[model samples]
Target: MLAETDIKDRYTSTNKNFWFKNMPTCKDRQFGWESNNKSVLFVNHGKTTLVDSLLKHSGLLGNGPNVCVMDSNELEKERGMTILSKVTSFMYKGNRINIVDTPGHADFGGEVERILSMVDSVVLVTDATEGPMAQTKFVLTKALQRDLNPIVVLNKIDRPTSRPDEVDSELLDLFMGLDATDKQLDYPILYASAKQGWCTKSLADAQEYIKNPPSDSQMGSLLDTILEYVPHPESVGDLDSEPFRMLVTQIEPNSYLGKCYLGKIQSGRVRVGDQIKALKPESGSNNQEVSKITKILLKRGLLTEEIEEGIAGDIVLVSGLKSASINYTLCSPSVTEPLPFVAVDPPTVSMSFGVNDSPLAGREGTQLTSSLIRDRLLKEAETNVALNVVSGNSSESFEVRGRGELQLSILIETMRREGFELSVSPPRVLLHKDSEKNLVEEPVEEAVVDVDAEMAGIVIEKLTKRKGEMKKYLEVADKVRLVFEIPTRGLLGYISELKNDTRGTGALTHSFLRYEEYKGPIEKARKGPLVATGPVGTCTSYALNLIEPRGKLFIRPGEVVYPGMIVGEYNKDSNDLEVNPTKAKQLTNIRTVHKDERVQLTPVQPWTLEEAIAYVNPGEKIEKERRRF
Candidate 1:
């Protein structure tokens, strides 16, 4: 269990698990991985697939007597990225080892920061081909700063271009660069082809695999390394005699249990029907709430079993706790001391979410009312610590804020899939006042880009135009890796352009940096949008052929068009074009010229929700740019 001092370390580190009851040996183990915080968290940059492979390789995917499995979220599957941090447990040598797989993308770094506090140790997985990529550095630096002991695993060693020794050297440099402690620098390194289901602790053993490939078998070496390297929670001192306390790390809504609060018991014990109260941080006005534990749930693979109780150091899901949220402390009613809470980094991006008022409103989606949208946003705010929702001045709009564009887009995409119709404005950076209350601060991000050597110049030019200040530059083989510090506002819609500039060969990663004094305004990539002059009709190819020459068209030939809907980009000097996309050409009697006979329209480049949101500013029309919505 994490004590008050340990909890303080969590917050100061700039951030910011489970168990099973079994009849195994009944021995009081002092040095085992599962002795205290039986939990180990998996952290990576964008290697969620490796995580899935690890679970399967560990036999947690099948009914192999494992306790639990971390099921990927719905959005995670579509995006090929982990969104929420998940927990699962498996048994290794009689010890119940709880594993948490977190998001690898830099966009979800907030999730990584918050979940780091839940576990006693970490498994820092890095790619074998791309040694110490941007995301690897991002997550590793956070773990190192938290003073968490991490086991570095060179995943995907089966890749033909893998250089295990070189990557090992780079990992050492990265550790030293992050000012890692002597003990942290002496971290264990393992080589594994997670896809092939084999791992070796010895460099020579890993080298021999090239000629005589090892059989696809258990990841025993990696598992044993984890057991040997990861320290037990008991090392942090025993807190079982203290009052019951657990910081809510996550929240979920269960059909049967209503709202389920998932967290590790920091002290004492809890059981079904136990009287407990919610202890909020000192800053909160409502410091406590009287509640009773109606039911206790334990995760076992894909299914959850109803448990009678959970003791200190065990992660459990408690139900019937109303109005509790992430960072809140759930403790015994007899206890008055509130556990320390790690405050998450503030949201960097914000956008307006309003009920669709366009001509196509409610045509494609059923849930178009502001009330429904508001309720959903509020519901999300209850569980998602990275999101913040506030009611707008008008009844038709709400302001949603989050860590980055990707995070906000995921929320919007979820709503879209759930039959939601909303008009979203371009994202803006959230601003805050410094201590003196006079200087305004805007969120900045440490942006890293890896691109082909030939395209490095162009990428730098693009980033420089967006107010990105170069911090570091390195050449790795035929590629160049560049690091910059840029305002969040500059990065909102820059991803699409960056891909274009690098010809899809570049990889970009960014994590939140400290907020600084506001940087000047950033100019938009495109001049303005081609607005539709619509009476609510489908777009015609004849009109599209004409309009596409003026700019890039966004709608297809037969797609429905609506008034005020953005149809294309405005490339000309005109402020905006109210072109009639539904306009039809008159019938021609004869086909004369070769090219004139056919009205071949250019392929429409439709704007994804993220692109569209980034294209438009707050209520400013393309033609009448004077007014701000």
Candidate 2:
């Protein structure tokens, strides 16, 4: 093993002043030090664009329409948002840098929490115009609590309305508000426009790059800052001599290689065919099993390349472990103690998933049996550590709990696309009992809303009626940012309403806070649902024309409807109203001149999976069909 002095000298003596005039060829640097830095790009503040630009500038991606490689899932592409944490790596100046792109939405906080354990530092991407958002605070808090080094990137500096100076100041204030330590307070900042594909260390340089078109990309400065600020794993100790140990952070099923577990090597080294033991520390010390490694893989660019051996500090994928799971430790047989694992926050919302029992159950989807649904849900729970599944009161239903409604909705959508049919109930906040106080507590969220100054009053009034308490309000130019502590259940279907109230210009985000004393009953602001209560038949334009005046219709003239199915939302009443949408106009022996006129029916509004889930109330279930509700 190298001495501590030698390790320190190795990094200090390397090419600290090297700058990339152009992309370098794939060759190892003569610096003898194996520098591998693992960093995570977190938050929704232009991380995807920055990641794509970095990969392109590194020559890992070719010039094109700037595809977001991290969001490879179909649903992610359709929604233009990330729902899962993805791993990718690139080589810069002969150093291997692993980057984990995590979900930015608060509902996927579980993904961000687990991946933080495997990364050494974080690149907290914040918007130049919006400054720190709700998700920005959520992820930054997690990174700070772990005492990880942070590098801030002020993205979208090229926007016409960008305010880098003010945003930078706000960022510093946020750090202080979060009680950051002296070391964390002193973070490095970079200015860039990821969409334009350039970044610089100083504001002047960024402005110059924006004014004068650079023949080559200027992302080298950001890469250099990362290598310098993020510490190498070897700096911890003589990790090469320690026993082989790795804590599984993520698990993915492979069609050809079975299950693949991805994690960072905490200590020692492991090679293909090496024998290892799987230890479940949370379950019990006696629950241990032996296994052999079949293949070792390392992420290169957007794909995984098989490697013969993996050393400490490197994130790798290992196969051939049949029973290994997340938070479990894979280590040398001689090592009995497992590495410490960070526990994620408990789920705040839950929904019921049951076998499709509607009349159209087996018409559209092929997988309709209860056993098939149960197996698929179990498989999902095995890899998704944040999600919990428990059997419901009957054999046909299961309660699925997660961080929030969006998270659960994404899972349901994924299952729907996979040819699985299931009924999903509206999301409900998971409540707890405070034993000492003998009081019931519900989950509360820290909500951040940005709306036009003119609409702020109505926004505040609406949220107040839902039991939301405003904690802080600030005016930014013509916009107002309001922070509130509100019950989780109060914000169930508020997104659509907020958009309507603000004319589609309002933005709102929230994150889990803590369980507090239950607030007294708050009246539901949502209107009643228009249920179709009649024999199964096709909808008629004559009947829908009359119902359009009562509320918005969800079905057109030719769509099929059945009893107990929600057809539309009632606008005037707050009680569930059953209407016969299948009723046809009585035929007349003699037709008047107006009777020959065509029926002028309003167009029906389609509901996405998330919208449908949010629109449902108690005792209402959204059926899974090829045609969305």
Candidate 3:
């Protein structure tokens, strides 16, 4: 067993083969983010919780004789999910390792791709109980394409129903299905319980450990496996000689430090105050600006240590670069060879973000002007390589395009929290031209749904109506797993409907499979909406009681209402009906004989932003929303 405290505290090693031992001598080496030699990228499909958990379980989060860096983003902490790629480092077995934690959800796939270019290898984390999921396949395909060998970690193996052997087989099938190379297919697998903080290379050992849990070394096998399987940075890059070059993978703004460009050094060495040039290959101007590096920060543990110089194959944060964008190469002035830029996955969904033109427009937010909205969007586009922001014909509107509705919704939620009032149009799929210049509307995705066997019929019916082709169906432990290749446009509001149909027991996962020709005229028609009538007023239970029998209500009593605002779903027909929610009861002979005279109203189905965006298409057209706010 490895000494956890020694591995956690004394990370720096004088071993000649250790990467950190090769750091260049320079002035002002107060050791702030000083460059570390080894780096590994952690890629998962939402299997693990904290990126630092694997290391922290081994006593790596505290003031280590080795440095630690952990996820500090407020949004990530709040959501309990990684919204962006986070960089952290730790020392193990006389080696310094920089860990890049990438988002697991497909919505943030672009972040995973960008971070892969900076590291030599990846740790592919998968859930043992669920096996390789939709996102697991998606992310694994990316890693294989990048030619990065993977070290698979079968996480959550301590679950009562975990089938490690079955999951292991499924993973093999996935690798072969994705056409992985033989070397990649022969990947190493380890069993772990990230929550329990123990891992073992052998399944039998893991089972034994579960019976008598080890208290001393919680995650030694994982660290050892990583060190054994993941190659050293020297094997991936030319550390001996090359100009100082790095492809900026992320750009972050700091009030005190201005703009900081974070990436791994591609070649040579860069010292603080070293003159570096920023090159934009896509800008088409051959324009380059020479600037002096003011500060260099490196990954130590959970925090960054200031370093004077950074060598090749090390991830570092460099300050003094202005307007630094993703894929921009920061290199020595004499270095002309630019690194290959990572192609951004094109946007499939678009929504118009316009100024809040409702009756209560400026009442909720301060940043309501088009100029401020446009500036904020442009700033986001600079850092978020996956997003596209283009101005609409009208000054008040800007079209925001992204991978999916969830991605766009996250942006909207972030802006709204920042006091920005905006009316978002219904999401529309962006059309693309195929190889023959044929008009293509959207990409087709493979949606895999698992639900109670009894509820499978309704799910199939719903999906079939949405132009989905059922590919396979299987029964597993009283559950039915159905696979369908469905059009992306049809899935916009399908989540809410699926939950309703399955009584919240269904699980759905989808991934972009391929782009196909326009599937013309998918039937998206449904019943009409119950709209609010006339002028703005407050809703009352008296009116709600009368309307409860006709449809489902979205508004509660005393809530502010507006004309044309959809209050509920009209269950009767396709025609929209205006209802008087502000109507008061007649005073004469209106007293009820029963005590507790509160009007009994059916519980209203509250609509979230995603649900509201999906429900308001009046004509079933794949365009903007017709419901007025």
Candidate 4:
């Protein structure tokens, strides 16, 4: 091997700003994040080791790449906003560790669900103090339902106040409470402190027991356990049973190939130029027919490398198979039985991705025409089965439904970055007719709230208005843990109020729950928004001073403002009022003695993608600005 000469050079790095012009590095020398995507591997070095070792081990000689899934954005780093499941690989067990790191937030559960179907198992990580929190329950429950065995790892065991024993028992109990079957009850537990960079399989060992010297540690044990325990699914099916088969999982964009179809090869073999019929989803059972595998691709670590004759179990990419979708079947003539498909959760939230009716609709984006927007949405629907786009007219808008706010937000954000200009309506729950054909609209979701005992009643009271029903209550240390089955409809706009009510000390977790019967207009909780009546040119401190007495402003001086644009929020009952934020103050030549000179404008109320989606009023809409180039 030409080792020394070949290893002469090393490198680096994108984000929401695919089209934006490259920004200069910040004053701190740390440039804001650029691009973000799922790393396609798992069980990274940091997956088992502490975070610091991940740095050292990945760079033992040269700069390394066995790093864990991370978001470099300041907001993501500080607040940990992983709205997507980022997959990455780590070298372990003499094999590549293909792992998917799911988000801790519940809103991103859709991302987690979509990615989980790709893996065979999951390591249920829990905090020693909090044990398996609500999100842990949400993710674990889905994992168990899919028959994926969970390897439990109690993290943060190094803290002096960490109660490992209690957390262990609680975790087991939580698993049971989630309707885990007898066979799923017993799971392996590992004590770990990601900061300490150590783990042990022994339960009798002290929670504080960690290898002090970092150089003395290794990831051999964790790797060995995964290799020994996690049974690799049969990559290719029985050779004699069929010719070749695969499941269409994800669709990728390629310049030469156009669309790259991602999936797992099941059986037989696929070679380039092989004649195979595309098995349409419409045909009856055992429906797959003849088509051709135009091209074959493989994943070399995080990058996609083209190949021929890929086997089963390994995640593969293919091209020339047009119309491939999540559940579509790809098989040879010799194969008849279609693979059982993994069904993603139905979307509970829906909103209209409509033409920008705002006066400045076509001003911001190039792809602002209705036909352009429709083409983009239809293209997305063709690939992403999870997204549903309802047909609408040129004057009307398209109704898009997705699992949650984050999913819809991602859709909007992606479209915006692609030069699309569209306004979105508020997200409403997608209701359905059960087998009985009854009108069963969804209710508020189940919420797990952790708050001080003194604040418990008020939290419950606020939840009650939102059609919340209690599941069970627990008292742990100085906190009260209560679970409630709340209706999803009334929960909208409640988060901000909840944070305000609890003084930002409460923890709330929620997931979509099965809908029973419809919950009547439970309670009407509404707030007014500051609407611009006339065309705004620019905000000024003097003009803002006059408008400040009316309500709060979203745009400070120097920021551009437009009519029909929501400039601020009014602190009052449900009522939208127009205000002139750009009215220039009538100047006077006469000067007065000694006075406070400057008037401070209120800071703009910057909204997160999800929050802005939620903040949309009934007839109002959300305007998205693509990262500028």
Candidate 5:
């Protein structure tokens, strides 16, 4: 081990080419190539070892922090890894486990693709009841294509209905469907309730496993299983920290730590003041100093703290820099090669985000301008590699695209919560060019629906009418698996409809399948909206009573409403309707006794962010303007 006291020459510079000019002296290719169709060289002389990312372990390797847990955003908490948090380290026996906690949702599948490239293998955790959700299949297929040894943790096995045996059978079937070799069937498995904090060989070891279940189990039973099967990534090449190298996996600006980056060190050792080169992931040979790291540290759960040294394959925190971008490669200035980066999927869905044009636009937000939205999105792009944003051609709007509707909606939801008033465009699929120069639209997903056996046909009929090709229908555990290859447009309205059809008991998961030839006109949503046409004032019971006769109401009496605001679904299948919010009943002294009854309005539908996003129409928008109701 290198002595901690030994020092290295270091300096900071504004030279953007610092990374390309200062290549570290090394004997072999130092960094791993990120796979996207083919592996592209990511970091040159910085030695990187493929790791399984063993998050929970029995023993530690070196002084690197052994326990790495994610501190994710509230949005991520809801969407789960639609953005991922990766904390790095190697477990005992020299195995590098770049622990990646990915979102369970398929919408954030891009995050999984990118994070998986930085490591060697994956530990796919699934609830015993869910048994390899739609995302599990999507994420696992990517890992298998990389020849990654998948270690399955049949988590939540302690539940009364948890079925490890059935799940194990299902797991093998998933593996076989993904084209796994017979050897892969010998894969290792563990049972754990990560919540309960214990893991065992099978249900039989329930007593032993549950004796203690800390988020970080120290008994080492699970870690031992991982090490036994998930072979260590052979240390590739040799590069000393005479210079330092790293990949920027996470980014944040600290009031105390300044600009910081979190990632596993590919090669060499980083000391405070070491002149590290920050290379843009897309930059082939060019690298820049941008700034210098003032400290070496590890993300100890939530925050970063100073550390003595960071080695290859261990998660690290570096500060005292200008700014670091996700997927950027940080390394010795002399290294010429860039580290492999995961290719994030192009956003299939998008929304127009601009200054909210609502009558109450400026009332609820701090910064309400197109320029603020532009600046914020640019800053987001600097960090979030998955988003694609552009100013509207007409300049009155901004076109922001992302992986899926849920993904884009989450962004809008986050901005709304942060007090930003912005109007978004209808979610649309982004088209691209194929090798044949065909005008191919963005790749849609294959929605896999698991519902009660009796309700299978409803799902099939809905997807089929929406241009979904139901390929496989299987009956298992009194539930049916109805798989469909549906366009992105078909899915927009399916979630709510399926929920209603299944009575909220159906399970659906979708992942990006390959882009097929343009599959004709995709189906639009079925329901129209009840648009309030003229005025800014409180909605009254009398006017609501007139409109409630047409469809469900979204606004109640005494609540504010404005022109161009979407009030409720029109119950019909079209757009552009007009209703009056300021309309009140005329008082007449000649009214009959039975006709004198007060106009008691029906209940107004309270809109949650997800529900509103799901309910929006092409011409109408989900306004987040504040109101008393």
Candidate 6:
């Protein structure tokens, strides 16, 4: 057990950075309580800002972009959301705490699902104004299923419209709805303003602290709470007696180390020179490859420290394993049995990635060959367990399946940024056959939408036309909360439409429910594309100006166009229109007395990777070249 010391005495006002700077040295701490404990912080969709703020205020991150240190990917930084789980450690009162920051988006739920198994406790960060959201329920359910008790943090409490009491009550109801056990229902709540770098046990204290600045940091309360509630790894078993075992949860490539496998030690200890064997538990094969550990790296404040040995419950990075992959068991050479691995939800969406057969395919990107694309995708699948790649009908294309459109789009966007030019087909839901019922079933998702009351009818009507069935509807204040169970196909291109209908004030999130009977056919009365028909040439402003009335243009002037290329959406009618966007205005010597009419074209609305993937119809493909959709 840990000692009960005065929280005030442990913290100091000597400097504003006392949160991390004033930590007790290893020499001053008691012997038994020095062990490290792991905890995870997660949020619902797009709520990573609170986690980033907490890390920055706690001194684990530095000043720069307004993104979490864990979200190191360029795309994640640009989007201001975490797409992967990241590990970092800090010292609080002479105790080491390993913190795992997981992505909030449901598309990356695989990251959260596997990460929950490595931590002993969870810190669920939620917006006070928004309360519990769709993804909040998803992640909380995963944690609850793992039997991990959560510590609730009502983040963004400083918002003017925040209602902590109401949100707190809603959280209780959410817990009850999830069928949480009695111990789980009695969760401790913290009111915090991660932006302001303060947290308190009560809403009044938090509000009072915000009004009057505190000289010392208030983040200690959170750290102290973890130490008090979260148990150490040794609590599970006697770590010193068991043989070494660890289940690889993450894999990353290192320029120097080749490949690094990350996971928490489940039993005993491992050193740099220890020999371990990688075993695939699910493969049901007896084959095992032995490898010697070269290095054990421990995460320390966003950086890793070379450690000689790692004990049970310590999340560490081990290198020198050439073929170790996610979900593989790394154990002592003497141990034969492997640890049980958590199963990830199967992918629900799939898309075909084919060689860029466009006329200008090889002009911009260096990697345009099908073989290179195949190799890159296979390498990604080795690390990203949630993604699966299989051969398509043709030799030049590969079908990639993943959790959702965002997951597949992120993969495509990442490949594009890496100089890989590939033609991607529109996303399609993966279907399943119910042999017992003798019925064809498709993937259904539970969508939770929060929008203004006036726009609820529009959202409902649009969704209903797509074969959506309303599950729940409630009016809260000036907004309406709607729940619907809709086929995944109906939601392919609906996100943008939802935003347009709500004027950008609505919040929408969805998660996979289960396979249900097909809901007949949903009408897809979408407009056709405008194809380029003339010879390849530079698009002119005059031609675009004249073509604006026919449809919405995807390209502006000064862009190169080729034959058979899709240039815009044909809005004049449902049939595809072949127009000459490259037709330059006639250069005539005769000049009229009247000034020439200026060509004013509508600004092109750019399509994000997800929107572009969702917009294409069957037999149509999105050409990814020079960042152009």
**Taking the tens digit of each residue's C-alpha lDDT, what string does model 4 give over 435-488?**
667577674566777778889999889888777888888886567888888877
Q: Write the per-residue lDDT of candidate 5 for residues 258-299, one digit (tens) a residue.
A: 767877666666666767777776757454655556877654
**TM-score: the better of candidates 4 and 5:** 5
Deviation (Å) of 466 in candidate 6: 1.6
Candidate 1 clashing pairs?
45-104, 67-301, 68-301, 575-622
Report lDDT (Cα) of residue 204, candidate 1.
Answer: 77
* Higher-scoring candidate on lDDT, 1 or 6: 6
**Candidate number of the best TM-score:** 2
Ranking 4 against 6 by lDDT, winner: 6
Alpha carbon lDDT at 397, candidate 6 = 98
Candidate 2 weakest lDDT stretch, 10 residues: 29-38
- Candidate number that wins on lDDT, 2 or 3: 2
Instruction: Work out candidate 6's RMSD over C-alphas.
Output: 6.1
lDDT of 1 at 222: 72
The best-first sequence of candidates by TM-score reads 2, 6, 3, 1, 5, 4
Error of 5 at 73 (Å): 2.4
Q: List candidate 2 segments past 4 Å from native.
A: 1-44, 234-240, 586-596
**Model 2 residue 283 lDDT score:** 47
Q: In model 1, which runs have C-alpha deviations exceeding 4 angstroms? A: 1-46, 62-71, 210-215, 235-242, 283-287, 433-439, 586-598, 620-629
Query: What is the C-alpha lDDT profile of model 1 across 510-572, one tens digit per residue?
Result: 777688998888877676778888588999877888888888777788887777777887888
C-alpha lDDT of all candidate models, in order: 0.69, 0.78, 0.71, 0.61, 0.62, 0.76
Predicted structure 4, TM vs. truth: 0.80
Cα shift from native, residue 434, model 2 (Å): 0.6
Candidate 6 versus the native: TM-score? 0.89
Ranking by lDDT: 2, 6, 3, 1, 5, 4
Candidate 6 whole-model C-alpha lDDT, 0 to 1 = 0.76
Our tally of clashes for model 3 stands at 15
TM-score of each: 0.85, 0.90, 0.88, 0.80, 0.82, 0.89
